[model samples]
Target: MLLLLGLGAWAEKAPAETSRPALTVSVQQVNFVDMERTLSATGNIRPWQDASVSVQTSGLRLKEVFADVGDIVQAGQLLAKFDDTIIRAEIEQTRAAIIQAQASLEQATQNAKRIRRIMGSGAVSQQEADQVLATEKINQAQLSSAQAALVGQEQRLAYTRLLAPYDGVVSAKSAVLGAVYNPGQELFHLIVQNKLQWEASVSSRHLSALEPGTKVLMHVREDLFAEGTVRQQSPALNEQTRQAIVYVDIVPGAQVKAGMFVQGDFKLGTRKVIAVPRQALVLRDGFYYVFVLENNNRVALRKIEIGQSLPNGVEVLAGLVSGEIIVVKGARFLEDGDMVRVALAASETAAGAGSVMSFARAGR
Candidate 1:
């Protein structure tokens, strides 16, 4: 009797559940999204053109400097100079060699003339005169060699002074007056003017939404209010993060500096379509649907097709239209065919304001 009574009680409860009214939910009309789909990434801000400056020769003291960090410089502008005392001395020695070679050449020419006259008069063997002529020709070649060496040495010595490679701002300085820079020592860093790029990463799944020349609005992550475009997308995705790098081109007018890390949004492109608050979309049995109320105050289940998603809402591609009443809040409680009471969004003003205030405080 006790087991039979327990079964009867469970059956009675089942009837109550079945007889209960359907779930109630607020509904929102399908709306179009004004903004396009965009992705965000966080890499770094860098100069579009950055250059490392270095010297080629070693054991030379930086004697003087005319430019420093933050200084605007033009191409070939003198930035610094090194001591050339030893180099000047070497140049002088090379000049002396050239003079000596020329003198020897003159002496050889006179000897050759004497030998030719002797050969014609039969005062010397023709073979001896030929040897003298060859010696004179050798002297002439040696003079030419010496002159070329002097020119090369002078040019190499002139390289001791450093000059700006392009019109840019000096971002770093290493070599100073009296500092000896080793061969290939880095001296200064230059950032070309009006050149900047933003580095950010986006999800690999959203790769289809990304492309070169896509417009992006980038700003510092901490302060998203400040905002730049998708300049380029990396061909390969990051294996660990499943994200890809994107570079945003920033023009000169924007108030941003290279190396200042920032965040930005990308617009995939704009489309006129259906959309609803994410809270309103529900999933059951792996199917997505929304709860709505009919003229009879009965809740209805409406399946929908979703498009691009945004922070505020999801784009509903189908099963809804503008000017149609739909649930915006309290969607989780209602079920299809259930009687539901309609509520106005205006009634939630105080609650929304309070939430906004709380969020603002948390941000601070």
Candidate 2:
């Protein structure tokens, strides 16, 4: 009879041991991170340096253009050509005038010499010598005028063959084959210097945190990316928008072009973050809670101090630790002292996953 009673008691204890809830669980070891707080804004990539080439002189139709839009050109490379018929004619005419002026100057010079000699002999009047000197002056003035005309023609001729101002790619083209353009007109836009800049904006409230050499990340569309440094910042925020402008210089990067739009986190430094993942948080009674797994895999209903909710996760300022696993996939049905499972490893969570959260184990 005693043996039967002992067996019955042992049978009851066995059910208690085997009655523990079976939970599929995952685990992770958490770590503390020192990271920069990135401020993000949308802006454009522009040339760090751009020069607008224009026609300085007006002229007739040209033969053809030697360079086209999007053409890579070097310094002094021929870009376009113009008809030089009028300039050539002008140059020839000026040359002829110079020859005539030279002959006249020679004649007047000899006349003055002859008159001076005769005056010493009392054979010629002083007025005659004076007239000869005036003729010489007139010849000199004529020569100067002809020389100036020839110089002007030469300059016009040089303008016919347009050249790239520097080593750059042609971004735009306005001049075409045999087209005549007026003064101050654009020809070709060049950007091949491969210099690009990113413009970032900061709100008035966060302007004080921005600094020179503050690091930033830029996400160019189509998977093309470029690294740019903060080169300039606006002195004052705009009154209407209340935002400050930041200029970032892009390093030579793959597939990054001038004037392409990009957006990303820019502010670089550490700030306080209240962070948590989507699944671990439960909305109950208009507040957020987590089924925190304790040391021995038991769960407790814990109230979390949250700041902001994000797309991927939430920020938990005061309710978690670095190395605790909170129920990620299924925690909505958990109660105090209930057995729960952590579906994902805390250590395996990526930096972008969300806030770090700790779980408490429940015991019966």
Highest-scoring model, TM-score: 2
Which runs of model 1 end up more than 4 angstroms from their true locations? 1-28, 33-35, 125-131, 199-209, 224-246, 253-262, 277-291, 300-314, 317-323, 327-364
Query: What value does the lDDT take at residue 186 in candidate 2?
Result: 86
Query: Per-candidate TM vs. native?
Result: 0.69, 0.77
Worst 10 residues of 2 by lDDT: 26-35
Residue 211, model 1: Cα distance from true site in angstroms: 3.7
* TM-score result, candidate 2: 0.77
Please provide, for model 1 over 191-238, each residue's C-alpha lDDT reduced to its tens digit, 9 standing for 90 to 100.
976477887877878767767777767765554443455667888988
Native-to-model Cα distance after best TM-score fit, residue 293 in candidate 1, in Å? 2.5
Candidate 2, superposed: residue stretches over 4 Å from native: 1-31, 34-36, 117-122, 205-210, 267-278, 284-287, 294-298, 305-315, 322-325, 336-364
Model 2: per-residue lDDT, tens digit, 82-117? 788888888998899999999998998888778867
